[model samples]
Target: MASQADRVAEAHKTLYDQGLAVRTDVTGADHVHRSLQNGSSDFARPMQELATEVGWGSIWTRPGLDRKTRSLLNIAMLCALNRMTELAVHVRGAVNNGASEIEIRETLIQVAGYCGLPAGLEGVRVAERVLDAIREQQSGEKSSTAA
Candidate 1:
């Protein structure tokens, strides 16, 4: 069997090469990469490992689905599962993968039809938070440009 560290390193390399970078949501990808590199046993270690191996390596690296489409599927699934927190994380990832707010909104609407109204509503709520933050950042950029 492949060692856990090896799997993580491969996943990290794949993610970097694909240009799918994580934002500064918490500790950042570098911190997680180091922890995975050193084989640390912190509280979130398991999740980090799973993210590297399963989320990044296995699923995200698949060539059949484009990153944007995968992100849309992830958002829909997370919402259906009532995973609000992880949903937010993927929402950010989706935006990084070139998913526009309008696309996300349409996805949420589609999820509503398939996953139920509550699930879709929760997705919209989380997506709105991310969208608002992005809008704020853009407005700040515009104001700074004018100055």
Candidate 2:
């Protein structure tokens, strides 16, 4: 009984839901929830849906690589592109996906050789900031648990 447009909308929604699950699993639930909240505006909703359905749904769900590899690749690519903000976000994602700090450092080192020194330096700075925040958060949890 659904109209053509309705069916397409439902399909897109399905992809979005799948993407949400995959993204949350990779990035942690709280971060995914906050990102969804920030993209709730009408103007931003389209971009959100596209990123969810396309980037997360299509590419992230592929079987060619594991999540950790994908996260590392993103960090490297973001560093090459000089996308520092996205680099920071993906640094967190890389950590969540089990990438070690050393792996991130190595990736940046590779980037410096290919992407130019300035971009690599900025990427290192951004990655360190995210890593510090994550380290601090983990320390807080450990202290609370100990107390």
Candidate 3:
């Protein structure tokens, strides 16, 4: 029989695995590679681990909200908190979660009204950059496949 400690460790591993999957689905394999690789940094290693374990595993995996809703909520909250860097990342995540451009626009509009014009404008700028990258990447994929 597995010991209690063993069981706990196994569960943690399972959640970590699930978190990786969830993150990959939302952020793409490329983003995951850049953000969470073992070679990235030992100093910020614990940050990645905690994000994977607690944020992605515990909160994001919850059934109360779908991934798209969560993505939108993250955008709004990140804007409200003026976390433009994380907001940019989650904007990409929002697209991956199936949020349309108009949906993103509307969310930013609300952010402008509620959060402040500066925050909303900055969020829009970040989101536009992320969306432009997505469009360019998709265009490249389509062109490459046409060859």
Candidate 4:
């Protein structure tokens, strides 16, 4: 049998591959690649590896909920938890998973009522930034294609 560290390494790779596939499918290859490379410290690297194994491998890969549903749930939960940074990332994920801006707006409104005005406001701000970035990317792509 593999050692604990070895097992974790294998699991992390498997989960990262699976999660990256889903993430890339939703957010596009460029965005997902950029997000995964956001951290570079030794500590950050190990923590990311561990998170990939547990968060993606253990939970996100589980049966029942599809990636779209999971993305929405993640947005809501991150908003409630006051995790703006993660919320921003999931906003992009939500879009990749086929969520419209209107749907995201509605969800934020609902979040405000349940999670408090402050959290809801922050979530909306983060969502706006992510949406803007997506639009910019899309337009850039269109321009490049047209050129």
Decreasing lDDT order of the candidates: 3, 2, 4, 1
Of the candidates numbered 2 and 4, which has the greater lDDT value? 2
> What C-alpha RMSD separates each model from the true structure?
5.4, 1.5, 1.6, 2.7
Instruction: Give the Cα RMSD of candidate 3.
Output: 1.6
In candidate 2, stretches whose alpha carbon ends up further than 4 angstroms from where it belongs are 1-6
The C-alpha lDDT values of all candidates are 0.76, 0.90, 0.90, 0.81
- The window of 10 residues in a row where model 2 has the poorest summed lDDT is 25-34
Supply every candidate's count of residue pairs whose N, Cα or C atoms clash at under 3 angstroms.
0, 0, 0, 1
**Candidate 3 clashes between residue pairs 3 or more apart in a chain or in different chains:** none
Candidate 2 residue-wise lDDT, 50-147, digit = tens: 98898898889889899999999999999998888778888999998999999999999989899889878999999999999999999999999999
Stretches off by above 4 angstroms in model 1 are 1-43
Error of 3 at 55 (Å): 1.0
Model 3: weakest 10-residue lDDT segment is 31-40
Total clashes in model 3, counting residue pairs 3 or more apart in sequence or in different chains = 0
User: What TM-score goes with each of the models?
Assistant: 0.71, 0.92, 0.91, 0.81
Q: Could you tell me how far off, in angstroms, the CA of residue 147 lies in candidate 3 after the best superposition? A: 2.0
The superposed Cα distance between candidate 3 and the true structure at residue 124, in angstroms, equals 0.5
- Candidate 3, overall lDDT? 0.90
TM-score of 3: 0.91
